[model samples]
Target: MTSKGLFVSFEGIDGSGKSTQARRLADTLTARGHEAVLTREPGGSPGAEEIRALVLQGDPDRWSAETELLLFTAARRDHLERTIRPALAAHRIVICDRFADSTRMYQGLSRGDLRAAVDQLHELMIGQEPDVTILIDMDPAAGLARAKSRQTVEERFEDFGVALQEDMRTGFLALAQEFPDRIRVIDGNRPEEAVARDVLDAVETCLP
Candidate 1:
């Protein structure tokens, strides 16, 4: 089912301000006379929300890499069926805070064989790709610091230590390189407004 809408996803490390930027971008698009739907991964729909809590709060030490990937894919499937695909079908711009990229980064960090995982998962789900993916790149230390400052209670992934988080950041960069046509890496070390503007510009360039 094809539609005249754009799917833009925001990706980044823990504290790259992707959530904030995604909202700003949606508001900007709406102000420009476009219908924009702001949603997020792992919890876009009610069913996905339950899966999200399980994935986020579960013990990381006990969770296998394969298990993590499957849980993420499950949530994503629910999100696509219940939220993303429907919104796109209605010709509304969909801005997601995080999507498949997060699974690649997180699971890729824990598991070495990520290519096969991505291929298999994509083949099973994700019929359509995002028109643009704005990657808010930032240093792992800085990102984690920001996340720590803002959060009162840390989650499982947040407890993965700095090294794993750094690996995840690198993983995101690699994914961006692999899909350069659809991914735009933006230096997220700047002010929030500046980053938001850059994201908006990238989306504008990609969308019709």
Candidate 2:
């Protein structure tokens, strides 16, 4: 396996089924007798959940890109302090829906040069990263359609339209290239079971 138990995170555009797949993988692992701790970024812990509401439910321009990024970082920091770090310490597989990678892509789209700032914040504030990041790669258009099917105030970012989704797709792909050892790109254009099969396949090999 990779280490003892794995700290896995699912990454992709909003509608790439990362959240669903993260849960599915966690459930699968539990059914197999593994202690998989399922969580999500910006809302895993109580403090973080408060931040999630602040960040995700509001006008599209409620917060500037920089402000929004900091909020995400803060929520992540809280989540780590209260949720993720403890789970990893207990040797449980932690499968998170989204992590710092989403911040890197979304904030980078707002301002291309902000990646430097985001990286700095991540290194200084939220030092830990996922052991394995599974990127559910999908076409921006198709993913957008999937995202829109859900009605939520989180539509702020998605309302930016196809161009933003396109850029995010490119950004996430580049991330896979940058962190090849820690990241894996999986095709998300398949059936749920097929996608779940591939996700679990990627995870099981690294199982403790």
Candidate 3:
């Protein structure tokens, strides 16, 4: 790998299996003799992980959209400093589970119409964008059911129910269009192995 490295992120609605795919990509790349650093947003570094708990747990309305934005930005900043940048500098492929685009959809579009604010803050603080992003698109109802079945403490977003998931799916698809060069949309309603193969093909194109 070149010193410049490659940054990749996996995105999708909850239960769309993006996290699983991200991990698989990292493992696959590593096995193929590449140095791959797999991490996640809202909780990649220590400080960010703490912020993740705050935002992901408790009641659905725990924080206002504006406040949540601040927290997410701060966490991302810490994650970049502690985890992402170093790995990139070392010529490692950074496969992130979720990144700024997730924020653009979840906190920016879903919580409220704060897309402008999200963009401005991102430019000012975390200006980095993924070299490639794979978005797993799934049916809102089925995705919601899968998310709810997890029964994890991090179900605050899931608690908002299927209505929010439906809106999120539409928002995410629009986001893919907005950043066509960087984001690739993949159908996630199929078998996991098939989705993984598609994801690998997508990332391989961007590999150095």
Candidate 4:
């Protein structure tokens, strides 16, 4: 990736509209003459996509939390190599729908306590973080309602119900505080246009 490019990620609870906003931001950047590569977690690259099916499909209890962590880390390493890094090396703005932060939140929620392991694994195998992260924050109930409307085969995490979503919101908010320098939490309960504007403004601050 060229030194001039920026790396950005959009993170939030499942139905918080982070993925939509990530796409919108990439479109905005492209309209303004920047090359933005928009991709999603566990499936951004060939190998990663393969891993995504394994983790996102089947029974939610199919894989142990520790085993799940290994799968995600492996996917991330592949994503970085085949997708993110090359885009950044070319100076393109890399806008990821989800990244390592998702791992910390999801695994922590499932296992009750595994965040330390997530961090350690990330540092050891996938050390890079986004130049900026836009976290779409909203009520968990609202987000869960939104999520339930979708028709996806990847229903493993969403099946955890609203209670888990509430816990996930807390986890995401905590992550924002822990990484204040790079994380920006934006209210995502508003219209998509409003959220898109906020996302754009947050990312623009980190751009060259």
Candidate 5:
């Protein structure tokens, strides 16, 4: 990696296996002798992790769409300040599980028509976009099934049901269209190794 470093975020509907791919990419890069900082949003830093517990482990409607947006934005700000920026400054590859695009979907488009507000907050506070974004495209039904099968308490979003997942899948694909240069969509219905290969290919252009 160059001194400028590289930021890569993985995005998908619940159970799209993006987290796995993110970790695999990080491990792959590290094995190649590159310093990679693997992290996740809403919980990357200490402060953000606290915020994560609040938003993730509650009733589906524990927080309103707007309130959730604010919470997510605040967490993102702290993450940028305390974790992401420093790692980039040190020239490490930042492999993030999710980023602003998530807020754009979950709290913005999917929850309500808060995309405008989401963008406004993002530009005002977290003015950084990942160099590359890997969007794992998966069937909403399948994704929701996988998500529910885990039975994790963080299923507040998943608890919203398959309809929400379907909407999110469409919204995510649209987001990829909106930012064609940065977001690359990969089919996640395939084997993990195959998905990881495509992910590596998507990111290869940005790597040193």
Candidate 6:
């Protein structure tokens, strides 16, 4: 079903600051008299939040890649049903920080054939696609360094070593290439405000 509201997603490596840019874009929309719903994947809904904790708790040694993918998909389904869909129906712009794109990147790096997984997920859960997805691109090492410098506590992914982080960045770029029309690649090595401006510009093209 089609709605007046637009669904936009922000995607990037851990320290790319997609969350900050997403919030800024939402604020921009609100200031312009538009309703915007700012949310995130894997924890947007109650059930999703539960799944998020399990997925991010750093059990890669215990969990298989397919298991990880399934968990992520389950969370995404819950998020879609309880949060995204209703907001869209209400004509609110949904600006999501790390949606299916993250799944494609991380899971794709974990396994392979990310396109197939994305298709399966769409068939099973996500009935619609985002109108636009801004990909904040950055060097994995630099991004991870920034993240570590800012954080007081480390997460599973953060502690996964440099190789995995590099894989994730490459995976994201591949996914962006696969969906060029839907994904806008933004250089995230710049200042936060500059990156935010680029994101806003990308979002403007898709907004009504």
| Cα lDDT of model 4 by residue, 10-119, tens digit | 88998999988998998999999988899999889999999999998888788888898999999999999999998888888999989999999998554558988998
Alpha-carbon RMSD to native, per candidate: 1.8, 1.4, 1.3, 1.4, 1.1, 2.0
lDDT of 5 by residue, 28-137 (tens): 99999999999998889999999999999989989999999999999999999999999999888999999999999999999999999999999999999999999999
Candidate 3 vs candidate 6: which has greater lDDT?
3
Q: What lDDT does each candidate get? A: 0.83, 0.88, 0.92, 0.89, 0.94, 0.82
Pairs of colliding residues, candidate 2? none
- Give the Cα-based TM-score of candidate 2 against the true structure: 0.96
TM match of model 4 to true structure:
0.96
Sort all candidates by TM-score, best to worst: 5, 3, 4, 2, 1, 6
TM-score of each candidate? 0.93, 0.96, 0.97, 0.96, 0.98, 0.91
Q: List the residue pairs that clash in candidate 5.
A: none
Q: Model 3 misses residue 3 by how many Å?
A: 6.1
Name the best candidate (by lDDT). 5
lDDT of 4 at 8: 91
Q: What is the number of residue pairs that collide in model 6?
A: 0
Shift in Å, residue 94, candidate 3: 0.4
Ranking the candidates on lDDT from highest down gives 5, 3, 4, 2, 1, 6
* Clashing residue pair totals per candidate (backbone < 3 A): 0, 0, 0, 4, 0, 0
The TM-score, computed over Cα atoms with residue i paired to residue i, of candidate 5 is: 0.98
Off by over 4 Å in 6: 111-115, 150-154
Better of 4 and 5 by lDDT: 5
What is the TM-score (0 to 1) of candidate 1?
A: 0.93
Q: Could you tell which candidate, 1 or 6, scores higher by lDDT?
A: 1
